[model samples]
Target: MSMVEVQPGGASGMTMPAAPKRRTLPGWAIFVIGVVGVVGVLATTSYLTGEAALTSSSTMQNTVTLGMPILLAGLGGIWAERSGMINIGLEGMMILGTWGAAWGGLHGGPWVAVLSGAVFGALGGVLHAIATVTFGVNHIVSGVAINLLGAGIAKYLSTLIFAPLSSNPRDSPPIERFDTFSAQPLADWLGELEQDQRAVISDVAGLLRGLVTRVSPMLLITILLVVGTYLLLWHTRFGLRLRSCGENPVAAESLGVNVYLHKYVAVIVSGALAGIGGAALVLGSSPSIYSEGQTANRGFIGLAAMIFGNWRPGGTLAGAGLFGYADGLRLSAGPQTVHALLYAAVIAAGLVVIWQLWRRKWTTATLAAVGAVAVYALYYASDELPREFLPYTPHIITLVVLALAAQRLRPPAADGLPYRRGEGD
Candidate 1:
């Protein structure tokens, strides 16, 4: 027997090897981890409240239904930011598209209506591109103008096409937001779940299957778009040059990058995305073209999601999901009452005072102020206990969530600022 290599360290004095050193995570990695944690919390909350299991299918359907548009729209923002432009008129674009889509889908032939919406939206995007890129108008200002025009046009169209309630004018019945994945195969899986035999695992799986869905057609399109954006931003040589132009046009011009052309392409892409988002809502969701104030600021909420996502495609997706779910809260939880109102008032006040004192650096103060004002406003605005306000509680909560995202999100170094070539962050 070969002598075993028993060194000085015998069994009793054996020294263990040192643990491997941990690699430090990059900032973006940490951000992703944070997002996962948040999702876990929501998933757990849904499971515990029985809401996760009960509303799984509907919630999943509803989220994909709402999120597809927003996600697509956010990609547009990503394009603009990547190229050092901004498109604020997405809400307006959506409004215009909605009217077009709704009129066509509800009243006209299906294909004709959908095409009408897409074509009209493409035109709107072109106009935005021209104003921003060709005219060198301020990005924010141009977007605002486009948004205004879109909102006005959409409202006018709604009134013209949709009959008034007094005139027995029925606009349309909206599409179903909730759908079941209970195909024959899935039904067998769900049947076992419905029996409640395995309380824990069954409920968890039921909730997962029910409450989450693959992005439908619209979201699928967005996925393609994100891939496109990634390729455009990081892979292609032209994309590298285009990004250079946005970050430093003067320097890019020196290097022979076509600054003007790239900017134009970016702004137009943004507009088109916004229009698609608008179409998703009007054509895909609402019964008829709604006349009210252009869907109560979906554009702004989209802005919030962009901000919350911290200017990343993946992050934006999470932000959109969060806002969509938040918007669903009131719908999922039920309407407000005096009990809710009174309790909300006290809590809001307490929060406001506490936030003023606590110096947690994450824009908590702003949230506190907004929360207090919102509580008071919501309470007084409601005359009935359960009658929903326009666009309802879900919409409002979503808006809040969006704002939080923007407040917390840290934009890339060159995100909003017009690029000055050769400078470093």
Candidate 2:
């Protein structure tokens, strides 16, 4: 005989038991876990390959210097996209900025260079705004036009302005470098600790040392901008309305928001930021010269970084850092250190397989497992990657990151959509 249990308050007033709550790690815990994992991977890779550069202070220093321009460009993308415009002309704006910075530096100094770069970049933004917002042209078309126009204009200006000064049509004369400061005592202490080479402790010391030593004022300003962007876009009233235009402009217009004004401002600011990025490239380099093609498609890379970050300031910084690290490794440490990275990738892939299996994603787990095995086999067979391939490492990283993050990406609902006043009404 089967016995039936009575429901609460009998059948008429039955209630189901509460479902179990899912557990998740807190933000700080997740951050700690990530840091620990990274340290572990680096330590293991260094030990296995006998490569000290993998976690050296110099490598970290180079990472910051190289990553700053990309970070600035990514920030510019964030501003325009957040306000409902896709500023694909960021590349063009940056090119203009490089020329502006060089010209300004030659006449005045570093600060003048920064200001000139911003102004030039803002001018590019104005062109974009007029084409996309005022005229209702296709955003992509407008952006491409800006890119071409920017290149042409830069070349023309260089020939007219820089040729007489530098005796070369494509190169600018030397510009003043930015002043840098360091926490010398802290740097010295960390240097000694890094020299000790005590696994995780030494690695952490090296990383900290890079940050405290020979720090640029622009780096501080960039950090402030990142924080400022987060606060402005998420916390302030103006930011809300601007973001609203991107999400639903008709509704925003109905609510008395000046969508056109906000879009124009956003795009202009975006250009200014991209211009600063270009300036950073000129000033940060050893010789402080603006050469033709110096932007090196970093604007596009910045766009990729913005997407990798899912259009957030903090995320953009992380994306830029990753790209910068790959680039720095290639430039500073060369092939042997990069080869050591293969071993670290193998371990990371193994972790991915385990994670996918735990989630019961059989296809993904199988793919990850296969990938891990394949990477290991490659590591076993190859000594080092070709030097020629090193230059593309950052781009490769960008592609891989975009692929991994594609499923989670969510752009603004009304982004890239043309808006005319009264249409929402």
Candidate 3:
């Protein structure tokens, strides 16, 4: 017997023509283009404003350090979201991890501190899983509750445990921090190249020098985790099952995948990663110690990064780096450097307008044109931005990035949705 394929809302055996495929650049080409564009912008800004910090090694070093926590938190967000859970409580878990790391560092050492933070964060994950998966609590409500509780608990613990040592309720005693290493001959060679200041080559040298100089072991681990996450999620059988749960739990269940187990595991891992992020913030500081409000809402920033990256690991890293770069620029080079960046923004906006026009997106092109004009006018009008507003550079960048990327994002089908076993049946 022969079978005829039936088309939906059409006669039997009828098929629709396939749509034409859109041409797109390969990932590597896109990456190279982005890198070259960024380098060129920095070079131009530095030359225009005569601010060397715009392309300095120290600035890039600060960017890596500042971006690490955000990257970790973003990774945590990815883990949870990919498994069909929204983790707004990453901040809370990070708070808990900070306390745990401080306490562990004082009693044991850096490694112990790391372990303690992970365990504490995992506990928070367990609580969230119990509330949302088993008891059917709203994910947002549970996450908010976790945030409040985590903060409260951390404060109380700080008073009870750290007050005696530090004579302060908000700060813990100093703990030993991890050591950093630099590549010897390569670092020296790159430093020399950076000093020579030969346009793009020097800028590239400076960037590489910063990466190799004073590098923390944890930073290396973070990079490994990013690459590992990509491999695991896209390549592994277990990852496929977990992602399936997020995409369609009912379908996953029918296929003998344990959706609840996958979600629980994913969320727990999420908390652990966020916890590590907290530990990174603590450890990355001079005379590392936990302090109240030290997290500075980096957890939320990280969530935003995850969204901007469209839930991919590589994209998340880029988002984190962008935010980190904005923050590092302000902190390392001050307002003069930031003022110079306005020119970069103007150029970027102009490029966006051009690209939108090329794509025949009239409305988007018009918006980009308006934005570019406004930014250019501001650059022309001001010598420097107000110092008070300078601190909010990273947050402002986050909002801007999300707004631009919002239209392009494609989240998992069942993300943030409540799930129950056998509901589809």
Candidate 4:
């Protein structure tokens, strides 16, 4: 399913920062929980399946690959929302990024691919901005247009651009992807510990060893974006005004905040970030972009991450991590029927469990995060967990969750509102 943003107003007023003052879980707790959760799940699976001979490094590497793009996409969406614009074109931008990177990397260099993607991403954003910011077109309609354009272009161009697998040259790289490191040492023993769990523990451990999850520099870049965006949205003067425009454009215009400019910048920056996410995905994942319907529904997933984070960069980062981890588990485990169902249960139960724990303050975000992983581990071990519904069910659930969250939270009054010169205010 898609993770679209649901508008939850700022804690109080526009000036009131949306970032929470106290985390139920400390940063360290989150780190520890993530570590424990990953290791525990990997170990249990390895032992149960007797695939323990595989190295832990490889599994971790794979996990990082899956999570990195999700992280960036989520945060990129947050950046746009911070300034009061809703960019629903993340998937479109992602395709542009993918296509641009593939072409640039092949014809130019890897760095050229990255740069070209960024430029094209900005171009896509410009297309969106012209309609929504300058011409006062509906933001949703503009986004839909962008998505359609991206789909059409990707479909028509994939065959034209990509080299034939049967090319005369045998040893050439097909698409340009960046290689950051040799396998990290931490991956080996990270999930190898033996625990005393009775049912299917060994199978979990073996799977972890066999998995080859790569750690990307992109993860570090994503972290920086979170911190940097947090500072920009909450600490900077421009951020305050930008956010104000999103919440109430009339009030901002009354105060001379230039509503059109804010929307333009916000949307454009959103495009840039989304483009970066695409580049990271191509460089980090498999070579080149998907041919047709390549982006699938990630644009929607990104929107969900933005809403889940309340437009805060830090929260968005954590939210992205949650998604990334969930996606990685599928690769880490064996049968789709088994792991996918387990993942769905974790996703389904996640918000409920967090809300339950949150009601009593007994559940910290880290705990919620950890509990989510724990649920997946349990679901993975059992065959009776409704395997068939697992793979595709999460998509429907995600849409419902986002829509419901939208009901609970009021989006920026100007979410789909366009910005114009004299009339916008």
Candidate 5:
């Protein structure tokens, strides 16, 4: 008998039923799983080897310090892009903010310094809005111009104000450090450890002390800002209209929403956020002096983090935290620590491949296997991370992650498109 069965009183051949839909995991779920798995692997390794260097408090502190600026900048990027304007002058704005904060701190206090940076950053945003919105300049071109302007203006002011105070015009006078409070009893308790267990206890204590004491107000402010950004972008009426402009300005305008006004506001707020990021750097991180290049491409990194997080405040925080952790490793780890991490990553990748293969996910299994092999190859090639490679680790991670996730990432439809008044869709 033939395998095909004929339908009674119908066609000569019968069709097969459709296959069931595959139950794919949500992106956020997958991200959380990955995070948990990585943490588990690191924890396991630490416990087995009795090496807590990877999980030290100093590393955690560094992560927070480095992640703040990136997180702020990412939030700024999210705002600008969500309002139909692409503000790539964040770096320049941050530079101005650094200088502004320095000047303000010298004259007033730390809090005033933050306000001054925000004002300067808002000025940069105003310039961007005038170019892109009022004059119909290309967004990218306007951003580049603003960057040049910010750099030139900062340099000029530095020469005028800082030259007499410091030997180098590029360096400003040291400002009073931010106020820091510590948990004295906890710190003391952690300090009272045996010599054999000192490293681990101290690392743990450092983390507790960092949390309980010596904390800056800027850190709390940054946390509040992240939460506020989330609320403003998702729950507010203004946010809905601003997002509508990014999604489809023509539609928004037809619905009585002023696209131009919202875009201007968005871009301006973006600049203010970037400026605050700069202030956070100086007040929370440095607090000593303003130096040229202190922003150090953190604005660009923030942009990358925004993309990595798909332009959501929560996601951006996760991305920034990840990058910050990587940077902390680069800053604190010696050769042995690096080697251990590399091996751990390779093992994790291999285990993932095995799990995927077991689950019959052929494509994922293959990719994981390839990643494991590549990482192992890298491990074999470099016994120790070269000191010179430290600075590029974050950038390299940004590039690789973006490359892998680009196809799955989506931006607002009208993000980079120009909209003019009375222009028909």
Candidate 6:
């Protein structure tokens, strides 16, 4: 109605009106959204499954404790592979770490336990280094030897050290655990949400409380190690050279990078990390005893996580979290929880189908739809899942995901290849 503004264009005096700028989401926002989405799915699943109790602060704390070892082992694998070595002996190394921790605890308490575990792990690394790096033994064979040696040594040491003390050759005496610390006020504030109807919020609050308060020293160290490893691998001169050895050791050696020395260092660090993980496992558990098969194939799972993560630290962490979540779910499974989880799976599948369709991926969308339908049918057909089968859920997920994503997965180019001083790949 304003005749004074006769111009067709706006204040800019352009022929065409300017399009509104898109409010693009920042990277951090996107990441947060993704996290929230995942959390929401988990929370809903828990609530529907009547497993909401599993999402409490205490459970989350337990999850982190259980997940820490897996994370460490995965990191160890990353270190070895990134330097052109394959460490299949992580399980053996971890076993040594456990014995070391027990020995240390017996002698000097918690601090000594950590150091002893590290030392023992380093010893294992030394043997591996000698076999693979110095003697040119096949990496897998060397690892297997280390595993056999570690298990035998642990059992022998148990008899010599712990058997007399505990009267048991298969297990060691209980060790003191590190003190758990938490902010009382914060914990109290978060604890109030324990009974919240919104399961997601309640779960988040519980996790926050556990993480912020009642955290153990070992947990802090584990987190620090993760950050430190990232910096060491990506931001340091030595790290670059070490990574180069894994990529092309021949070229690296030509460029004056001591391939053998770096390989030795890498394997040593790998063992150290694995040792820390083993110590964490002992320290995090009840009675804190080192027993036979205590590691329970966590090392293999770590290897699987490494593969799932595409050999990156961040990716490895994510993979470990997923596996840990599955483990947690299994541990806390109930009739309600299982039912909720089943429904949650169907809903998740439906969301996947919708997401694919939104992206205009017809085939993918159709597949997702079919998958969703299949999940629903499976849930409908089965009245209930056996409780015993719950323990294998994580492993089953790992196998399925790997099978589906194996084609796109890539490892360091020379990850398992032998690097002679003058050889070419």
- TM for every model, in the order presented, reads 0.68, 0.93, 0.94, 0.70, 0.86, 0.88
- Sorted by lDDT (best first), the order is 3, 2, 6, 5, 4, 1
CA error at residue 281 for candidate 2, angstroms? 0.6
lDDT of candidates 1 onward, in order: 0.59, 0.88, 0.89, 0.61, 0.81, 0.82
Greater lDDT among 4 and 5 belongs to 5
lDDT digits (tens) for residues 108-149 of candidate 5 = 888888888888888888899899998999989988888888
Choose the strongest candidate by TM-score.
3
| Candidate 3 similarity to native, TM-score | 0.94
lDDT of 3 by residue, 151-223 (tens): 9999999999999999999999999888899999999999999999787778788888989999998798789
Count: clashes, candidate 4: 44
Off by over 4 Å in 3: 1-17, 26-29
Q: How accurate is candidate 2 locally (lDDT)?
A: 0.88
Model 4 C-alpha lDDT per residue in residues 208-285, reported as the tens digit of each score = 433433434566666687678778877898888988887777788888888778777877777777777767667765
> How big is the positional error of residue 217 in model 4, measured in Å on the Cα after superposition?
2.6
Per-residue CA lDDT of model 2 for 84-130, tens digit only, reads 89989999999999989999999999889888888998899999999
For model 6, give the 10-residue run with minimal summed lDDT.
1-10
- lDDT measured at residue 38 in model 4 versus the true structure, 0 to 100: 49
Better of 1 and 5 by lDDT: 5
- Winner by TM-score between candidate 6 and candidate 5: 6
In candidate 3, where is summed lDDT lowest over 10 consecutive residues? Answer: 1-10
Clashing pairs in 6: 48-340, 49-336, 49-337, 49-340, 50-336, 181-214, 182-213, 182-214
What is candidate 6's lDDT per residue for 267-324, written digit by digit as tens?
9999988888888888877889898889887877888888887787877777777777
lDDT of 1 by residue, 248-271 (tens): 667677777777778777766676
> Candidate 2, which segments miss by more than 4 Å at Cα?
1-36
Which segments of candidate 4 are over 4 A away from where they belong? 1-60, 159-173, 182-214, 288-290, 336-410, 422-425
